[model samples]
Target: MTDLVLRPMTPQDLGDVLALQAKGYPAALHDSAEAFLSRMALAPTLNLVAHDGGGLRGYLVSHPWAAGSPPPVDSVLPTAAPQDCWYVHDLSVAEAARGLGLARRLLIAGRDAAQALGLTRSELIAVEGAAPFWRRQGWSLPAIIAPELAAKAAGYGSSAVFMACEDIAAL
Candidate 1:
């Protein structure tokens, strides 16, 4: 395996990141290159790219969310203490990079970023197929989810679990 470097994603890397997302996830979650570039410009630090010697290998995008609020579908929620919580929006590792802990590394990097911002917790909506993985990583379902988020997640069926990690180290 090649050495991996984690860096803030740039506009130039958007296409590669979108391609990787398409390869890793279904169309529903794959954003267009323009959309991703826009996101990178809006929240550069949270848009992280993992690169090996060849090119982009993986990427993760996390945004802070307000406690007791619905997950924002089009924008990050306004918060008095934005650092208190983080929402892991998307995490994707190239097929070639799977099973090598690259996803874990990207998630850990997001956790560190959240900690640096003074966040005490991190949250994500895990699809049914991802629940086991999140559980293994020390995340648990929260007691309540915002109605809007719940509605948005209806398509995921009843098995989708909203998981959170209170400690970055635990992840």
Candidate 2:
């Protein structure tokens, strides 16, 4: 693999991101390309893309939790103040990009961005058999998941595990 370049997601990159998401999580429903593009534009910095010379290889999308919002368990809700928590909505690496550590790099980038913005914690929903992978990356399953999120994740035939890391340094 050539040197991987990481950059903020652009509107033009929506198709590629959605395609990768479909491929990476065939069993899970995802945001439409339009929705992804809109969110990316609104929070470009939090929507990161990693690319090799070939094309987009991986990406991670995150958003801060709403003020006074209970811990995220289902869909993310917008917050008024810059919440101390950052939620990792999605992270996917192309099949060809696997084993290259692109996912880890993207994750670290997200964590760094969150920390740079003064977020004290980072969280994500681990789907399918990804629990072990998140654990290896220093994320631990929390005691409970939000009820709303649990039902939403069930549609994907998997329960969402709440995982958290103390700081970007932990990545």
Candidate 3:
């Protein structure tokens, strides 16, 4: 593994972030620029990117959100919503950067942010058959979301699963 730097995402990094997103995920799962900007604005505390000798290698986007619910895909969120769980909106590692534990590092960073917010759990919608990766990171699909949230999760894909985890190292 090479030395890497993990820091907050910046406006200048959006181009690389979008490109990496396109390469890291399938077309159907790609997020719009507006959505990215909105997440950055509403949840700047948790949007992070990893830089190595080659440049951006991975990124993680998360936000404080309500449990049993997930914001609809490609949609902006209100700043006034009550938040009880740290929601992980996106996580990506470049193909060339895999095997370096970049994803896990980003996750741990997100987890730390969640813990900092005094939240006990973290949640995310797993798409592109990436549930196993998330599960390996200590997340679980308890089917804990409501019908409305479930419907929103479906927009990511037919097989998207809403997962949550209480293991962010504080426990």
Candidate 4:
């Protein structure tokens, strides 16, 4: 196995990150480079990337957010919201990097970053058939959710669903 390093994602990593995004997700699911950069700026400490000498492996985009109140897809918030749930906006591990536990490590990083940020929970809009994967990672589908939050999740796509990691680190 090749040695891989995890580090805070930087602007220099954006192009590769976007390319990895393309490989892991479809066009309709793509988030713009501007939005990705905005998310990194909003919560630098909560975001991370995995790489080796070969290049990008995966990236995780996370931030502090209100529990059960995820932001809309692909749009950057004009201002930061008060810290609450540590929201994982996206996690994508390149196909070649699967089975190496990079995605798990990225999520673990998000959970740890959430704890460090003083947030106890985490939320994400799981889309494109990723729900089962997240479920195995200890994320749960909320039994109930507000109409607005559910609607925001719907914007992700037909298969998108709202999931939360209660007491994030516990799992």
Q: Point to the candidate with the largest lDDT.
A: 4
Poorly placed runs, candidate 1 (over 4 Å): 68-83, 144-149, 155-159
Report clashes for each candidate as comma-separated counts. 0, 2, 0, 0
Leading candidate by TM-score: 4
Per-residue accuracy of model 4 over 64-118 as CA lDDT, tens digit each: 8777777776777555676778888999898888998888888888778778778
- Model 4 sits at a Cα RMSD from the real structure of 1.3
Model 3 — TM-score against the truth?
0.91
Each candidate's TM vs. the true structure?
A: 0.81, 0.82, 0.91, 0.94
Which is the better candidate, 1 or 2, if ranked by TM-score? 2
Over 4 Å off, model 2? 67-82, 144-156
Ranking by TM-score: 4, 3, 2, 1
- Tens-place lDDT per residue, model 3, 1-171, is 457999888888999999999887888888877778777776676889999888999999888888877888777777676678888999999998899888988988878877877878888899989899888888888855678878888989998988888766642
Candidate 1: count of backbone clashes, pairs at least 3 residues apart or interchain: 0
Q: How well does candidate 2 match the true structure, expressed as C-alpha RMSD?
A: 3.2
Candidate 1 on 1-171: residue-level lDDT in tens? Answer: 457899998878877887887787776555566556555654567779999888888999876666444253334333333345777767888888889998888888888877776676877777647888888877887777777666656544455566778776667
- Which runs in model 3 stand beyond 4 Å of their true positions? 143-145
lDDT of each: 0.71, 0.71, 0.84, 0.85
The TM-score between candidate 2 and the true structure equals 0.82
Once fitted onto the true fold, the runs of candidate 4 whose alpha carbons sit more than 4 angstroms away are none
Better of 2 and 4 by TM-score: 4
